[model samples]
Target: MKSLIVNADDLGRSAGIDAGIARAHREGIVTSATLMTNGPGAEGGGAVARENPDLGVGVHLVLTYGRPLSDPATVPSLVEPDGGFPVKASAVIGRGRVRTDEVLREYRAQLERARELIGREPTHVDTHHWVQEEPGVFTAFLELARESGLAARPLNDAERERLRAAGVRTPDRYVREFQHPRAIDVAALLALLELIAAAGDGATELMCHPGEPDPELERTSAYAVARPVELATLTDPAVRAKVRELGFQPITYGDL
Candidate 1:
């Protein structure tokens, strides 16, 4: 049977987002979520995790958004004057502003924060903006995952191969939708589901960012409007039923 893991990213970005992730896990098709260690709603996300033990939680290791868990002095190249990371992933990777050792240290700090807040080690790890795709960065991240005995999200074929070479496991396939803000078309999401169903065997991960709109999200994220639409798509009865109709088994990151 084909397995699917609906992993929601950015669990602790805001209270609204945290609530949406909780609803998606409890009432919809979401099987897992990735928590932001330094997110504004981290406390709420921790509460949600405690309440819903069945919902597998991973660390959404951030490198391009919000504040870093590490000291700004130590990672001067990775932080802005405001103490948060640059919004663009290229600013860090393309410019060679971030050091590999600094990245490793910051990632470990974020993992530690996640463990403290979520009350356990994260089941897996994923980057905030696909920053792990950068050459040296992914290797360091893979090392961290291996040391922690946790899985990491493989965003593409190359990343999958890299993970395989390192003896790390990920879902057999990964699916995600990239869209402009407020343009989360449900029809497109459904089409993605159909495409994944028609593909080869083994487990696949469907990544989504779903949430309710609120002041915090509006202020912090440019993708705010798209969040609610994504939430609706995930919780839609039709979509949930379609997964069953396609004979897909919903699993979590841990299950990979």
Candidate 2:
């Protein structure tokens, strides 16, 4: 009845990031990861994952701040004219500039990129930047994975039927919106507990990013020093004990 999956996102973003995920999975609470198709150190991450088949690798469908799987010029609707996905999704959604058709095409390309590189359709699907959660992009993104007959995000018992109909896997929870710092107050942890509890019967994809609190990641991501905090949380004996106290057995996408 109590199951959880501690997942690391942005696996190929950097050596530092990838190494942190590897270590978290190897020695901490990390149970799965979503790979960035256009990420740096992608090849290295793939090699490591290949060697460690135990790691649950899924596609972190990217739609912003990175290279597109399709030519940017061709997939203009998916990115800015300059080839980057929009920096602010709200502005794009507000302006109605998001070309859903182009996005669909580009997402398909992202899927193919995952297959070509990782040697198979991803075991599961998650979006980079949580872009799939965006309004126009959400259902269409799910359709793309459904078309490929791959497992999609499963959130409930009724949805479990949906996934079963599509021959996909189903889980109850996902960790979206992870921008907060690790030095969270009681309110933050309480909020997280609330979110996790909302996912009634299925598994939860507990998303996190764990890395060193150093200039290397700081210069590149807003999550710089925060990575160490995440690592700390994963390695935190107290937090692990809490999972046990809450009765959530950790799991991954491959567990289905």
**Best-matching candidate per TM-score:** 1
Report how far off residue 235 is in candidate 2 (Å): 1.7
Candidate maximizing lDDT:
1
lDDT (0 to 1) per candidate: 0.83, 0.69
The alpha-carbon lDDT assigned to residue 176 of candidate 2 equals 48
The 10-residue segment of model 2 with minimum total lDDT is 181-190
Model 2, 1-256: lDDT tens digits are 8677777888777777777788777777678887887756677667656755677788777777577878888877777667777655464444555677777887788777767666654777776665654556766666776777666664345555655676666566556444464443334544675568666666777778777555766876787677766776676666656666777777777776
Q: How do all models score by TM-score?
A: 0.94, 0.82
lDDT of 1 at 121: 64
Stretches off by above 4 angstroms in model 2 are 154-168, 176-179, 182-201
Q: Candidate 1 has what TM-score?
A: 0.94
Q: How does model 2 score by TM-score?
A: 0.82
